[model samples]
Structures are given as structure tokens and as C-alpha cells.
Target: MLLEIAIGDAYGAGFEFCGREKIMRSNTLESYVPHELGIQAGCYTDDTQMSIAVAEVLLANSDYSSDAFADAYVRCYKRDQRQGYAKGLQGLLDLCVNGADLRQRISPESRRNGAAMRSVPLGLIADKNVLAQAASEQAMVTHNTAEGILSSHVVALMSHALLYDKAKLVELPDFILEITGFILRGDWAAEVECDALQTLHAVNTALQANRCMSTLLLDCVNFGGDVDSVAAIAMGLASLTPEYVVDIPASLVNGLEAGKFGSSYLRKLDVALAGRYPVLSAHLVRQS
Candidate 1:
């Protein structure tokens, strides 16, 4: 789970964040960039940033508290202007700023990508039940819509399983199906106003290669809408089965700038994980 978060953070910072300049680039150029630059340079989007927010909340409480989670979110949004925050998240922050009932204010009205992006952190910090609660509360605060909450909730619960439940990763499809089945059975599935289904469908198909990172990139990008969220989920899946993640490409791992955006903090995380589990560092070193 920790390793997954680190990779998600790296991808978020490397690819998603840097791609902002691409809006002005030619369509042809835009198409060529990802393949040329690779996913390593692909920074994370609102997804990883929100995950960071969740992690901050967990660190403070060592558990999931809806109130504390909401507070941390507001703080993260305000602190990181470059968090790739969108309007939906901004609204949640607004409600938080106004001291609104976060649980009630955030409802099924939001069918946006906000929920799925940040939910991964909760997945890592808590168990499935707590993860589901955190995802639901966070979603309800701004995205009252059923799809919105499901998007985040399903992914968060899956992430939790991936990180803590070793048995789950071995049967990836069953795990994804478990979450999807819950979403399908939930009230959120009744309100099908958004393209979230498309994203979920894509995710379902992509999980077939549930053991391969390259397969995730293909499925995530090619599967169409909500590539960032799709990729984020894929990252969660891949993190669950790191044995299949392969080594980080030399080019992507080499030119990383480690002095910015608490890059050192990320390294510290890496060191901690490595020290506690020498095999991880050994794997990384071998990959290097």
C-alpha cells in the first residue's frame, strides 16, 4: 500500500502535473507525448493529491474520522494550489470553510472525478469499512450524487484490500468484481446520469491484465474517459500485486528532481519502506 501511494504520487507529480503545458500543444503532439515521455513523467492528477490529503488525515488520527478527514481536505486544497483541484473539490472546500455539515452538504449531485482521486489514501490508512465510510463522507460533502460516491467508494475499498489484504490481490478480478458488485447493488447505480459507467467498464476490462503495469497504461489510456482516475485505480491494483509491476524505467527514474514539493519526504518514505523490508530495496536496487 505504501509503495503504491509512492508510485501514485510520483506519477501524479511527474506526468499529470507537467502535462498542463500540453493544452496548447497540437493534437498530434499531445498524442505523441505520452508514448514518448512514458507514464513515469506522467504526474498524478487530482487523484494523488487527494490521496495525500487522506494520508495526512490518517497520520494525524491514526484512524478514519470524518470530521478530521474533511478538515485535512480543506487544508490540503488551500495549501496546495497546484493540487490540480477542480470545481467539485473546490465546492467541498467552500462548504468546509463555511462550517457546513460535510456529511450532508456533500451529496449525490456530484458525478465528477473528485471522489476516486483522493480515495486511495483512505484505502491505505484504514480497513474496508473505514475506507468506505471515508470515501462516502468525502463524496457526500460535495458530490452528493450516487455515482460520485460509488466512484470514490469502490476504488477506496479496493485500494484498502490491495494494500492490507494479501489474499485479495492474487484473485484481482474477484476483488474488482466484489467492489463493482457492491456499487451495482447500491442506490448510486440507480442514478446513471454520468459517464462513470464507462470508466468502470473500462476498469473492469483493464483488470484482466491486473498483473501488468504496461497493460494498465494501455487499458487506462485507451479505455477512454477519465484516464487519470482509471490509471489511479490501476495503480492501486498494481500496488496490490507489486510482483508484476516490473522495474521503473531507467530514464524515468533517473532524471527525477528530488528537491521540490517535499521530494525529500517521498524519499524518506522510500527509505522507511526499504529499511523495514530489505527485499523491497533489494528489488529496487536490482531494478536500478
Candidate 2:
């Protein structure tokens, strides 16, 4: 899931906010493109970095808490400050001393897509009820809004459905309605930047699809604003869509940055996460 998040983030990194007209002209998905951060071809942005933070917290034997999530996010952000975090958040990351300070300082209730973007790790928990509580806790660490929490819940639950019971995904609009008591209406326009509702709709649409990772990712970028995040959040769960690398382009994986927290790290995290859970549908995945 983390690996797929990085791939999708990196895949859409090149075209973030370029809008529909500019991205369509490229007409190709064969290789990594230049990222807005001016990083190397396949180096991911804050999406994968913060996701690694969430994964590490889950990897820990200690209990999950907002302090822990905040600390992990701060550590990851400090490790790579120039990785294209949002301007408003970049300032917050600098002043806050630790996790405790972050929670207090992040007073402005943001409904941005960050909550949903880093939420891929929450789906690893098999129990749906427990997962929902944890998802709210993690999202409230920064994005403490009704919309923010709801979007996180939707992505985590949908990811769980994709992994455990894909058929339940068809019931997403209903499941969200049933669980959150929130009605999901249609008529969402594209160009989804940091908006929680729009991104949730996009992730749900991507998960509702059983498309190959290649097509899923390309289609995500075509959705326009904040394309990288939509792709990252969608691909993290859908990465386990049973297609594996056979359906995924080799270049997307091989071409990822080989830094300390790059593709190799993501692969190890996936292996460790799967070891801690029952991956019923992924028995055929390539270990290598």
C-alpha cells in the first residue's frame, strides 16, 4: 500500500495543478515526469513521506495516539523540508517543537486532503470499528474538521474493503451514509486540489473501479488539481488490486528514488505490514 502510494504520488507529481488541458497534451504514462519540487524523476513528495510516518507508527508496538502521529509527521517533514509541503503547513512544521506542540498549534480547522492522503495505513487494521476511531484520531492531528474526519474515514474504510471485501466497495456511498450518517451526493466537478470532499469522491471512484494500476493512475492525473494526492490515495489501496507488478509498469517501480526512504523502504514496510495481518487475497504477490 505504501509503495503504491509513493508510485502514484510520484506519477502524478509532475502534473500537480497543471489542470486538464496541459496534462492531456502529454499523452503518455510510460515514465516518470519532472516533479514540481524539482526533485529527481521518481522522488515522491510529502504524500509518501508523511505516509511513511503513519506506517512507522503502525509498525511500532506502542499504542496509537495523536501525539505519536504528530511526532512522526514532524520527523518526516524535518527530514525533507523541501519536499513540497503546502505553504501554510510548512510554517507550522517549523515552529512546533514536537507532537504535543503540533496539536495545540494547528488550531485552524483545515479540511484539506492531507488527512485522506496519509490514511492508507489505517486500512491495515482488520477490524472496521477500531479502524474508524483510529482514522478520526489521525486526521484530527492536523485536519480536525467534520469533512476532514469524514473523508479519512471513507478512504480508510474503502481501502479496507478493497483489501478484505472488495464487493463492499460498491456500497461505499451507502456505507459512508450508514457509518458517518453522511449522504454522498453526485455532481462533483473535477480539478480537485486540497478539498476533502472532492478527493474522497475521486478515491471512492478509483476504488469502485477494478482497473489495472496503470489505467487507474493515468485516469487520476487526468482529474486535474492536486492530481498527485488523488493518485496517491487511490493507488495505495488499489495497489493491492491483485494486479501487482505484472500489471504495473516496471519503470514506475524501478524508476522510484532509491534514497533511504524510497522504494526499497516502501517495499519493506509493505512486507512488514502484511506479516502483521492476514492478506487473504494477496497470496500470489511477488515477494522479490
Candidate 3:
């Protein structure tokens, strides 16, 4: 799922903020597109980086507390902080040294998709109940709003349910709403913005409308604003589905940026997480 997020993030980086008409015209599926931010093709952004931070916290600490979440995110952000973070977040990342600093300075009302994007790995925890709590906590460290927190929970829980065969694709949106009580309605054809609800709706819409991972991701990017975030969420979830898993092309799997915390590192982390989670052992599709 983390690997899939990076693929979608890198794939959509180029067309982010480009209107639906333009994106539909280009329809740059099956490969990475060149980003205006000058990010190299197949290189992911802050979306995947912060997700790695959350995954790192989970891997290192059994507690998954707020402090560990904050520290891991700060450490990950500081390593190489140039992967398309929003300007306001860039400033916050600059000032925060640790969990204490993060607690003192982090905004409580910010409702962005950052939390949802990073909440992917929370689904790997064996205990679904514990996973739900960790999911909310992980989002609270960054985006601390009802929508922000619930959006993360939805993403994380959806991942868990799908991975464990607790839910099916057709019933996913209803199941999420039933559990989280966060109803988000939107047109996938419309512009998807930075708002947590809108982004989640767009991603959900795209996921339900398309079975092919490539088409689902295309639906996400075509929505325009915050394209990478929507695509990242959509593709991450789609990768878990048996039908969609094979639809992802090899170019994305092989073409992602390589180095520390890059393609190879994500694969290693996936293996390590699967070793502990066991549930993930049979579905290690990052190498597939």
C-alpha cells in the first residue's frame, strides 16, 4: 500500500493543479509525468515521505504514541525536505524539533489531506481496534480536525478491512460512513481541493467508479486541485484489491526514484512490516 501511494504520488505530481480538461486531454496514464515543481519523474512528494515517517514510528515503537509520531515525522521531514510540501507546512516543519515542539506549534484546526495520505500504514497493525486508535492519533499530530482525523480513520480502516477481507469494493464507501460517521459527497469530475472531506470524497468516488488501478488513478488526477493527494489515496487503496492489483504497470514499480527511503527502502520496510504483521505476507505485491 505504501509503495502504491508513492507510485500514485509520483505519477500525479506533474498534472497536479492542472484542470480536468487539460488532464483529460493528456491522460498521462501508464507512466510518470514530468512535474512542474522540477521533481524527477517517478519521485514521490511529501505525501509519501510523511507516510514513511508514520510507518517508521509504527516499525520502531509498539506504543505508536503522539510523541513518537511527531518525532518520526520531524526526523523524516528534516532528512531531505524538498518533496513538494505546502509552504505553511514547510515553515512548521522548519521550527519543530521534536514532539514537544510539534505539540506546542502544530495547528489544531488544519483540515488537509496530509493526514489521510500518511495514514495508509496504520492498517498493517494486527489489532483492528488498536489500529483505529492509532489511525486517529497519527492524523491528530498533523491535521487535527474532525474531518482530518476521521478522514485518516476512514483511509486506515478501509485499508485494514480490505486487506483482511472484511469488506468488498462495492460496499466500501457505505462501510466507511457507517463506521466513521463522516459523510462526504462530491463529484469525481469536479475539482478536488486540499480540504480533507473533498479529497476523500474524490478518492472514494474514483475508487468505486473504476476497477483498473490505472483508470482509478486517472480519475483522481483529472479532478485537478491536489491531484497527487487524491491519486495517492486512490491508488494505495486500489492496490489492495485483487482485481486492481494486476492493473498497475511495471513501469511504475520499477521507475520510482531509488535511494534511502526511496523505492528499495519502501520494499524493505514492506517486507519488515509483513514479517511482523503476517497478514501482509501473502499480499507482498510491491515486488510483483
Candidate 4:
């Protein structure tokens, strides 16, 4: 799942801020294209970096610790700050590095996709009942707004559900709407829709049209705002389906940036977690 998320993030990184019309004008969306960063075509952004950080903390602690996760985020940022991290997240990570209280440092009013981007790991590692709580706890490390937390929860829950029940994907949009509506009731319900909801709505539209998974991924990335995060969350759900798994190109997986905590580290975490959880091991075997 982390690999899929990273691949999606990398694929979309090049088109992050491009308009939908420009992306649609491209000849082929199957292969990666280099973004303005001057990095390689398949290099992932802070989305995968922060997600790997979360997975590392989860694998090391046997339980979620906000401080440890914050430390991991700081460490990853220090290792590579060129992964296009949002200014708000960079500020929070700086505070974490300086030993500040992370909870207090959170940007409660800013509703960026940082939380949703990295929250998939919690979904993979946690059970359904505890998934939302874990997502909120991790999200609150940087994004404390109701919108941010709820969006993260929606991604986490949807990822978990998709992993176990790929057949339920047809109902994903309604599932997202139902869950988001329940979370943001009354006054909050009338607020503007968050990026996570917009992503899911796009997914619902694509599913209804019977589009190919690759096209759906392209559409998600081309939605314009928070492209990498939205595509990561959407791709994480889409990747669980057998058809979509085949749609992921070999170049994307082979092209992930490599280092101490890069693609190799993600694989190690996946194997370790799968070993501890037989169900995940079986799922991995099926994927292989």
C-alpha cells in the first residue's frame, strides 16, 4: 500500500499545480514526467516521505506515539527538505526538531492535505475500530483543524476498508459522503467541502464512467489542488483492486528514489508488518 501511495505521489508530482486542461492535453499520462523540481521523473514528494516516517515509528514502537512520530517527521525533513513539503508542515517539523510541544505547534486553522497524505499507514496497521482514532492522533501532530482531522480519518478508514473489501469500491463515494457528513454535522456540515471529499467525489465519478484505473489515477492527480495527496489517497484505495494493481506500471515502482529511508525502507516495513499480521501477509502474497 505504501508503495502504491508513493508511486501515485511520484506520478502526480510532475503535474501537481498544472491545470486539468494542460494535463489532459498531454499525449500520454502512463509514464512519469519530470516536474519543476529538476528531480527524476519518479521521485516522490513529502507525501511518501512523511508516510514512510509514520510507518517507521509504527514499526519501531509497536504502538502509536505522537512524540516518536513527530521525531520521525523531523528526521525525514532534515534528511531531505527538497521534497516539496508545505510551509505549515515545515514549520511544525522545525518546532518538533527544536523539542517544542508538537500538539501546541499544530496549525489548527490550516486545512492542508498533509494529514491525509500520510495517514494511510495508520489504516494499514490498525484495525477498523481504532483506525479513526489513530489517524486523528497522527494528524493532530501537525493539522489540528476539524477539517484536517476528519479528512485524514476519511482516508484512513477508506484505505482500511478497501484493503479488506475491494469489492466495496463501487460504494466508495457514498461511503466517503456518509462518513464525512457524520463527522461534520450541524454547523460544520455546511462548511466548504475539504480536499479529501473532492478527491472522493472525483473517484465516484470515474468509477461510474467505468474508466480504466490508470485514467482514474490521472484524473485524481489532475484535479488541481493538493494533487499529490489527493492522488495518493485515491490511488491507495484504487491499488487494492486486482485490476488496478496490474495498471501500475513497472517504471513507477522501479523508479522510486532510493536512500536510507526510501523504497527499500518501505519494503522492509511492509514485510515486517506483514510477518506480524498473517492477513496482511496473505494479501501481499496475492498482490505478488
Candidate 5:
């Protein structure tokens, strides 16, 4: 899940800034290089950066604590602005700087992908209930919309389901549906069930995050409509598979600048966590 989070963070940024025309015209996922898209490689958005913050908190606390997660987030934001921030992210940053309770800052007011983008890491450490709680808390800091919280919860649960069970691979859709049903049943103040279902539909029709690592990885490479969020969710879910660990692709991998701290950190994280990947493989799909 960590490796997927890393690579998805790296690759998803290409689509965040590119229009649909360029996305459709691109021949492969590799074609959307940071430079071609006018962004730099190894420059991840807030999704992966915030995820690392969550991981850091989990690593030290060994338990779920919303305050701890928020503090870690503030620390990261203070350190790096290039963390692929979302709409209204600055307000949350400001609140943190003012020593405000993170809980007070977050409410269901808007449905940005911010919460969902950084949700995978929490799934790695907690069970479904705890994962949902942590995901909610993480987003509550700034994302106040029902859609925002639902997206985060969905990603965390899906990732948790994927990571914890190996034998249930064949029942992926059922699991998604079941979890989706469970979440939608809660009183979230808005009908974000539709939005969550749309994302699930994208994952199902375009990127199958449950069947195989290769399937989900390839799906992420081609999926549109908040591709980073889709890719992040897919990677998070896919990373749960013991066989689906992510490794940097070699061709573009070598071009990564080592001097940049983000690049260096990702490289080290790859070395520590990524699996041995194929040299170069054909993209499974073309941009639509």
C-alpha cells in the first residue's frame, strides 16, 4: 500500500494539471512525465506527503489518535508546501498554526478529494472501525463535506479489506458493495453515496483494484476523473495483496533526481518496501 501510495502520488500529479485533451492524447502513462506536463518528477502532491505524515504518526503512536495525526499533518505542511495540497487547504494550515483543535477546523462543508487522497496509510495499521475513525479524523481537519469523508472512508476500508484478506480476492466486488452499503447507511448529512458509488463504478469498470496487482496498477494508469484519487484508492487497495508490492519502473526510475529530498525519500522508501518489478511492460490501456 505504501509503495502504491508513493507511485500513485508520483504519477497522478501528471493528470491533475493536464486537461482531458492531453490525457486522451498521451500514448502511455509514462508519456505524462512531469516535464512534459510542466511539473517536475518526484514532485508529489499533498496526497502522498500527508500519507507519509499519517504513517509517521502511526509508527510512533502505535494507536489511532486524531490529535496526533493532526499534529503530524501540521508539521508536514509547515515543512513542505508542495505536498499536492487541495482546495481550502491553507485555512486548515492556518488553524493548525494557531494551535486550534483540528476537530474544530473540520466539518462536512465541502467535498474535495483531499481526504480520500491521503487515506491509504491508515488502513495499513488499523481494523475497519479504527480505519474509518482515523480516516474521518484526518479529513475532519479541513474536509467538512460528506463526500470528502465518504471518499476517505471508502479508500481506507477498501484498502484494509485488500490488505487483510488474501483468499477473498475473488469476491472483490461483493466486498466493495458490502462496504459501500455499510458506509452509506450511516447518517452523513449528505447524499455522498452517489459520489462514492461513482468512484466505485470507475474502479470497477476502468480499474479493478481487487483482482490482481497488475490489473489495478494498469487500471490506475488509464483511469480518468480525478485520476490521482482513483489511482491512490486503487493502489491502496491493491497494495493489500502480498504479491502486489510496488517498485519503481526502471526507464523513468533512473531519470529521477536523487538530490531532491522528496526523490531521495521516495527512493529510500522504494528500497525499503517496493517489490522487484518488471523492467518495462506495455500499458494495458490507452487514455480514452
Candidate 6:
């Protein structure tokens, strides 16, 4: 799931700011291409970096800790500040590193998709109930808005469903709708345009068309705003099946920048995670 998140983010990195028409002009997103970051073709953005941080902290502590997660996020940011983080996240990290309490210093107005982008790790590591709590905790570290927190929850739930309910893959659209509807009836009902709802609607529409994995990814990217995060979430959900996992091109995996966490980190994390969870081990073995 983590590897799929990174691969999807990197694959959509080049099209982050491009409109659907612009992407259409390019024909197909067969491989990596340079984007505004001016980095290598398959270099991931802050999405994958923060995700790895979350996974590392969870593995080390064996549970969720907002402070530890915040510290890890700050560490990752300092390691590579140019990973296309939103202005709000950069400011939050700055305050955190300077001794401010992240929970109190967070900007509640920041409803960006960053929270959702790094949430796959939480979903993979926790059970259904714990997943929601951890997703909320980690997301509120920077994005304190209800919409932001809920967006991460939706992604976490989708990831959990993908991992444990592989047989019911076709029911994902209905599940997403039910979840989003419940969210809208809550205290954050005013946040109708939240990223979670938008992404769910997009996914539901795409699934209704019964498109292939490549087309689904490309459509997510071509949706334009917050493309990388949306594509990453879409990719994580799509990767539940062996077919979609194999559909991910080798070039994107090969092109990712080998930073502190080298290319092998994905395989290493997979082994470690599977070892820790027998259910995950079964899922991975079947996928393999």
C-alpha cells in the first residue's frame, strides 16, 4: 500500500498543475516527466516523504503518538524541504521545530489534501477503529480543520476496506458514498466541498465507467487541483488487486529518487509490516 502510494504520487507528479486539456494534449502518461519541482522524473513529493515518516514512527513505537509523528514530520521536512509541501504545512513544521505544540499551533483553516496523502500508512498499520483515531490525530497535527481530518479518515477507511475486503472491491463506490454522507451530517456539514467528498465522487464516477487501472490514475491526475494527493489515494485503493499492482509500470519505480529511504525501502517495509500482521502477510502473499 505504501509503495503504491509513492508510485502513484510520483507518476502523477509531472501532471500536478496541468489541466485535463493539457494532459490530454500530451496523449498518455506512460512514464515519468519533469514538473514544477524541477526534480527527477519519478522523485516523489512531500506525500511519500511524510508517509514514510508516519510508517517509520508507527513501526518503532507500535502505536500512534501525535508528538512522535510531528517530530518525525519535522525531521523529514528538514531532510528535504523542497518536496512540494503546502505553505500551511511548512509553517506548522516551523512552529513545531521551534518548540510550539503542534496540536495548538495548527491552522484549522488549512484543509489541504496533505492529510489524506500520507494517511495510507495509518490505514495499513491499524485496525478499522484505531485507523480512524490515528488518522484524525496525525492529520490534526498540521491540518486541524474538520474537513482535513475527515478527508484523512475517508482515505484511511478506503485503504482498510481495500486491504480486508478485497472480495467486495466493486462495492467501494457505494461504501464511499455512505461514508461521505455520514460525514456531511456531522458538525462539519458546512464543508461540503471537502477533498474527501470530491475524491470519492471522482472515484465513484471513474468506477462506474469501469475503466482500467491506467485510465483511473490518469483521470485522477487530470482532475487537476491537488492531483498528486488525489492520484495517490486513488492508486492506494486501486492497488488492492494483483492486476492493478502489476499494472504499475516498472519505470516509475526505477525512477524514484533514492533519498534517505532508498528504493528498497518499499520492499523492506512490506516485509516488516507483513511480518507484524498475519492478515497483511496473507494479503501480500496472495497479491504476490
Reference-based TM-score of each model: 0.67, 0.90, 0.92, 0.81, 0.73, 0.82
RMSD of 1: 6.7
User: Which consecutive 10 residues in model 5 have the weakest lDDT in total?
Assistant: 279-288
Local error of candidate 2 at residue 99 (angstroms): 1.2
Worst window of 10 by summed lDDT in candidate 2? 279-288
lDDT of 2 by residue, 124-198 (tens): 778898888888888888889998888888877767766776544456578667777766544344778689888
TM-score of 3: 0.92
lDDT of 6: 0.65
Clash pairs, model 4 backbone: none
Backbone clashes under 3 angstroms, per model: 24, 0, 0, 0, 10, 0
The C-alpha lDDT values of all candidates are 0.51, 0.76, 0.79, 0.64, 0.55, 0.65
Compute the lDDT for candidate 3: 0.79
Model 1 CA deviation exceeding 4 Å by range:
1-43, 88-108, 168-170, 176-180, 183-195, 255-259, 267-288
Measured by TM-score, the strongest candidate is 3
Q: Model 2 scores what on Cα lDDT?
A: 0.76
Cα lDDT tens digits, model 4, 1-288, are: 677777778877777776566577651555777776564677888888888887777677655655666777777777776666766666666656532455556655657666777877676754665677677777777777886777778777666666665546556656666666733211111111235545444544543443355666666665565567666766666655554544655666677777776678767777786765544564455334
lDDT-best of 2 and 4: 2
- Model 6 segments more than 4 A misplaced: 19-21, 91-104, 176-196, 207-212, 242-245, 282-288
Question: Per-residue lDDT for 1-288 in model 3, tens only?
Answer: 678888889888878886556676766666787776677778899888888888787778697777788888889888867658887778888998777787788675778888888887888876778888887778888777888888888888878877886467777777777877776463556787888888888988888788888777777877788989888888877767675644667777788889887888888887887877777776675346
Residue pairs clashing in model 5 are 45-83, 45-84, 46-83, 46-84, 107-144, 108-144, 108-145, 109-144, 109-145, 163-240
In order of lDDT, best first, we have: 3, 2, 6, 4, 5, 1
Clashing pairs in 6: none
Give the lDDT of residue 174 in candidate 3: 75
